[model samples]
Target: MKRLAPHSPATLACTMLLALASQTTPAAARDADKPRPVVDFTSCAKPAWPKADLAARHSGTVTLSFNIDSQGKADAGTVVKSSGHAGLDEAARSGIAKCRFKNGPGAVQMQYVWVTE
Candidate 1:
């Protein structure tokens, strides 16, 4: 099987999404009343693509719901929206749990998108 390049579209898209998520725009700052993302992506580690899912070309977005402790640690997440594949959903959930969030002591719902290019 051919492996994806380090800079593949999927990888690039994930990086872009993380970058966008970490930025606080003037508009966002102005709209401080609005809710913020559950966790911070600025220093979050990227989730690895499951080898089986990658080999099978499985892709979709998984929405997760979970709680963040006061210290920014996340609990094991519940899958609010499945990626149509168990492996993908589990990988996303596990990866998200490992992230260090900026906000804490609250419930959060977030999504992780998986795609093939």
Candidate 2:
């Protein structure tokens, strides 16, 4: 039988955190347990993209972090992680910035994807 090498402290810590995070209730579910965000993606306008160019030129995920204010409005958040393309990231940011949420409490994190062939 083969044995794997031991994980470093950092790696172990990251694994533990990931496990804990996964076990925790999702943001949406937590919100549902309380008052749901008034401006959830379902209610907000879907972000639009340049389909033709996107399909031909770019493909990746745009991880955006935006605050859903008490009013349910989506305040402009940071791009913590991004897809490779600047244009795609910018587009996602712009789309999210335009969205508004109904009255609610706390902020929410959102991620958008832009894929190409």
lDDT of 2 by residue, 54-108 (tens): 4445556767666666766767767767777777677777777677765555554
For candidate 1, what's the RMSD? 7.0
Task: Give the TM-score of each candidate.
Answer: 0.69, 0.57
Runs of candidate 2 exceeding 4 Å displacement: 1-39, 50-56
TM-score of the candidate numbered 1? 0.69
Best by TM-score: 1
Candidate 1 residue runs with Cα over 4 Å from true position: 1-37
- Residue pairs with clashing backbones, model 2: 72-101
Local distance difference test values of all predictions, in order: 0.70, 0.54
Which window of ten consecutive residues has the lowest lDDT sum in model 2? 14-23
lDDT of 2: 0.54
Model 1 per-residue lDDT at 61: 86
Model 1: per-residue Cα lDDT over 1-117, one tens digit each: 777675566543432132213224576567567554466666567788787787677888888877767788879978887889999889888988888776555566777888766
